[model samples]
Target: MSKPLNIIFAGTPDFAAQHLQALINSHHNIVAVYCPPDKPAGRGKKLTACATKQLALANNLVVEQPVNFKATEDQETLANYNADVMVVVAYGLLLPEVILNAPKLGCINVHGSLLPKWRGAAPIQRSLEAGDGQTGVTIMQMDKGLDTGDMILKATCDITPSDTSASLYEKLAALGPEALIDTLSLMATGEHTAEKQDDSLANYAAKLDKAEAELDWSLSANVLDRKVRAYIPWPVAQFTFIDEKQNPQRIRIWQATPLQLAHGKAPGTILTADKKGIVVATGDGALSLTSLQIPGKKPLSVADILNARGHWFTPNTPITGQINE
Candidate 1:
């Protein structure tokens, strides 16, 4: 085996930290760890370190938290690390050309999707929302573009119909670390080859926001089903409806299925509520919401929720936010 290469790791969040943990367990020498600066979080808005920063500190690694590389000192400090390669996973910051070239073997990335497919901030979530049959990880030679890098390794995974964003994220987390280690081994032996991505086949995955989670009942049931699954664990798909008490209420849908049975009820109408699920009318079909959550309460299955608040979801009630004309 070739000598272990000097590596610098840049990442944030739990997904990135998993890859960092893999490198720590390997033979490579991690010269430095770089992540974004701590930001205020929680109700108190107290500054909080990211997952990678916490992990790096626990391992007694040299940690650097730079807001950006525009400062000359920051750039010089990184270059002085003298690293053979830098592994970036969900780093969130755009690297300048100088920073990309500072390392001996250049910077490599553990992207969450197969290149030329879903590429950008929320690959895992976007793939689920698009209802793709399969998605995977791509270890690439990093460049200035947004995930438009030359691929060094590819690891594929199936996207089951029941898979949510959180589940898909876990799947990639498992595949990414192994792929990163393999890519580093090949790089150390000078056996890695780069494959250029076909620019025509790429799709951008824009960052997620709460606004998009508002369920538009006017859309098809299948489309709404995908959105509900993709938005799980963050800004869950929600809809507003007037409750039995005559007050507007927002309900978050955590799990749902598209029912093929046709219905004449207007979109957003509550078609039925039973042990199976809360069936709601949509523009093209019906959706059965299996798991749901009310603000200030834990998520509950449709049966459980109905047992507690059976009067709230009476059939023929119209959900708010859309006109039924």
Candidate 2:
């Protein structure tokens, strides 16, 4: 059995919380947890604790919410922990060299991608958008450059045709803890090896933007279908259209599928509107919008939406939006 080591955990959000929870259940000692400070959220704009902070506090562990590692005092406090190692997962803040070197074994991170592929802020979503066959958790030895770390361990999971960002997030989150614990065990036993990442194959996953969620009818149905899956639970796939009253309104498409229509029509034209779905023409194929929502309303299936507002989306009506290449 591997001996327990003093560990400092740093992360934010639900993805990070799963890793922290696994550490708490392990035999190792979680000396402290570092998370982002509470930020205003929701309609009331009240300050809310991050998932990591909430889990740490519930387990009676020390929690630190430092904005960054630039301060001398903060550096001193972190060094005082005398942690054998620091484990980071989805921790939004960048670690300074001083803090990284302070830990006995240096800092390590549990990243959501396979490294050298999707290495930036939104790897999960980027992988879906790019139609990658698979993605996984990577345990890396932290370095100064962004995700340009030595790989310690990895565990892959497939990106299925039916996978949305939300579904893929859950799978990666569960895979992370198992991979992390195994890496820690290897490090403890001095059996872990570091593999350098190839910079030539690296690709940056730029953070998602609301602008990217706007559906462009000019794109192929397959591409737009992937975008809808990629942007779920964030800036969902959306399109703007002038309603029956000639008022411009935006609708978010929650679920959709691509289809090769027998007869072609102009892109953005509504081909069919029935109980099954609202089939719209695309540049190369057609898309069946199964679930959708208007502003300030709950999501509804195409059948329910047709029953409520069939007149708004009559056949031949065109959905307008800015087209991007």
Candidate 3:
């Protein structure tokens, strides 16, 4: 049998936590875990541990939450672990050259998108927002540059028509652990091949902005639809409309679909409204909103929303880009 590797697992979010869990289940010796320091979260601003740190603690593994790797002591502490390899997934911190080269087998990362494409902070969301047909996980040999690394392995998945960022994240998170484990095993056996990334084919996925959630009706319905899907479970796609009292109300769109409406109308004008959905005209076509929510209210399907506040979403009302006082 191949010898178990001494692994130092580093990650922060749920996506990273899943990979850590998979490593723990394997026969590899996890020497230590590194995660971001606890940050203030929720209403009371209580300090909250990252998903990876929580998992590592639950499993009784050594956990370290270093804010940065610039400190000499931190560097020495990590080196002391004497890990054969380091596995990083969504760790959200920059690793200096000293830390990167400290491990015997060097550091590797489980990135969310197919390498050479969508290589940045928000790859998953950017892929969905751009209407890409497919995306997957890439096990990359880490380099100093941002996601600029040699790909050791990759596993692709189709982006379905109904997929949202949240859904695709779950899918990729599930796929990551298997690919990571296989890559690590191959590395241990000296069977893994590293493919240099093509610079010409690379794309950067810039971090998502809350401002982008504001729906611009001037855009094509197809574009709007993709944006809605991309922003799910984060800064949700939103639009503002004037209520009966002339007050502006903002509504968050949870679910929507692009449509091919025959009639030419002003974009943002409500074409139809019923229990099933609200169809609004757009620059190219129309968008049918299946689910939406107002501030302080849980998301509800159009049918349920209409049952309580049907008057709020009147047909012929125009959704605006910005709320007017």
lDDT for 325 in candidate 1 is 60
lDDT of 3 at 297: 96
Please, what are the lDDT tens digits per residue for candidate 1 over residues 240-322? 76665667778899999998878998888989999799999999899999998887799999999999988778889775633
Whole-model Cα lDDT of every candidate shown, in order:
0.92, 0.92, 0.91
Point out where model 2 deviates above 4 Å.
Answer: 321-325
**Range of the 10 consecutive residues with the lowest summed lDDT in candidate 2:** 316-325
Clashing pairs in 3: none
Model 3 C-alpha lDDT per residue in residues 164-183, reported as the tens digit of each score: 99999999999999999999
Q: What are the per-residue Cα lDDT tens digits for candidate 2 across 126-157?
A: 99999999999899999898999999999999
* Worst ten in a row by lDDT for model 3: 316-325
TM-score on alpha carbons, each prediction: 0.96, 0.97, 0.96
lDDT of 1 at 316: 90
- Candidate 1: regions farther than 4 A off: 244-246, 321-325
Q: After superposition, how far is residue 27 of candidate 3 from its true place, in Å?
A: 0.7
lDDT of 3: 0.91
Error of 3 at 55 (Å): 0.8
